[model samples]
Target: MIFLLSILTILNYNSNSIEINNAWVRPAGKGMNSALYFELKNSSANSDELFKVSSNAAELVQLHKTVNKNGLMEMKEIKSLKINGNQTIKFAPGGYHVMLIKLKKDLKTGNKIGFKFYFKKAGIIKADAVVKSY
Candidate 1:
């Protein structure tokens, strides 16, 4: 019955909410760039759209997608990311991610950054991005 109760507890959360897990930011190397990764579990029983992402450490932030064109991988902006009912979408390196633009400072290991995720249904969620190696 605990499993069923767990289900109910999750469902009882905000109707437009998402559970974010493994939230992290990449440690800066020679470059001033960093990437944020997370797993977003949609338990709202409906679709949701991720509209924007932002952090105080960057001048600009955008939802990015890695596309391979002729074996060359390039990053591009994604206006809206869709999440299906009761599904988890992972944002990680070598795949879709949140691009932190124009670093304010170098992100070192053990450091952390705070981010806000804005969505159509969920409104906003504040999460910490823990720095770690790739």
Candidate 2:
């Protein structure tokens, strides 16, 4: 009975997982820079921290946020972002986004790119983003 309860607990924890949706990457040429946007939803009862992001599409993948400093807009790199329980974070334009620096190759329209998101509790969450010209 103890073993059965343990199994059920693990299953329930997995069911309440983080969800990534509407992931998309901007089109860019080789050696150029691009950005990725997505919506991250945390459904678990506990809050999570997103610490790192990685991708093979670019040489460097970093978390960044657009800020308006002294009436000038600038992009700044952030160490980590916290997602509250049952909350949704939108990584869109003029907000938090993933910077894809030094592209390995041309990302044309409809091309797909894979990324890995490192979290504190949910572990590594893999997501795919389509190349688009938004």
Candidate 3:
């Protein structure tokens, strides 16, 4: 029952709402840049766009994607990402990610970092991403 509940919690959101699930940040040394990965779900009837991401733990925050070009994997900044209604977008390794640059301090494993994400229609969402080695 607990597993079902957890799954439901991750999957379900009210109308015109957004939620983050399994949010995690990579562990890195002080002053080093790290990345965050998560699943963003939209349960709205209308499409939503992610415009900006911010965090106090890093000097700069950006949305990035790892693309394969000429057999080389390169990270590129993405200005915005649109999430269709009832869609779930995965920000995983080797794919779309949140880039946290110039860390204010070392992100130790098992710690949670707070972030504020701005959306075009959903407004600002505050999330806490856990730090992990993976």
Candidate 4:
């Protein structure tokens, strides 16, 4: 009975938690910088904002969004991202992405990099980004 109660309490405590996954640094060739993609899930009762992103492998990191302008693909800066309660937001290619400017090192396939996420409500979350050829 005690263990069951403890489990319930823990679950309740974490009911408003947020999580991130599948973050990776895109593969790069000579003179080519990289971008990052990931998924953000928020189970909180309120929404959250992803204000900033940072990584050690890149000299600068910022949020970017892809838009169709005059039937052409264009990328622009995103000031923030909204995460509704009990919802997930995905950052992928041809959509919202993390722009990795000024490469510090080469990202090879099977390599993993560390990234830090800045959230308005959830504060900071860190995750390991894997390098893949996807």
TM-score: which candidate is best? 2
Worst 10 residues of 3 by lDDT: 7-16
Backbone N/Cα/C clashes per model: 0, 0, 0, 0
Query: How does each model score on TM-score?
Result: 0.84, 0.89, 0.87, 0.84
Error of 4 at 16 (Å): 7.0
* Candidate 3 residue lDDT tens string, 1-134: 99999777546543338998899999998899999999999976668899899999999999999999999999999999999988999999999999999999999999999998898776789899999997
Q: Which pairs clash in model 3?
A: none
Tens digits of per-residue lDDT, candidate 4, 63-103, equal 99999999999999999988888899999988999998878
User: How does candidate 4 score on lDDT?
Assistant: 0.84
Model 4 pairs whose backbones collide = none
lDDT (10s digit) by residue, model 1, range 27-117: 7743377789999889867778888998998877889989889999999989989998899999988888998877888888899899999
Backbone steric clashes in candidate 1, count: 0
**CA lDDT for candidate 1:** 0.84
Q: What is candidate 4's CA lDDT for residue 18?
A: 78
For model 2, what is the alpha-carbon lDDT of residue 44? 81
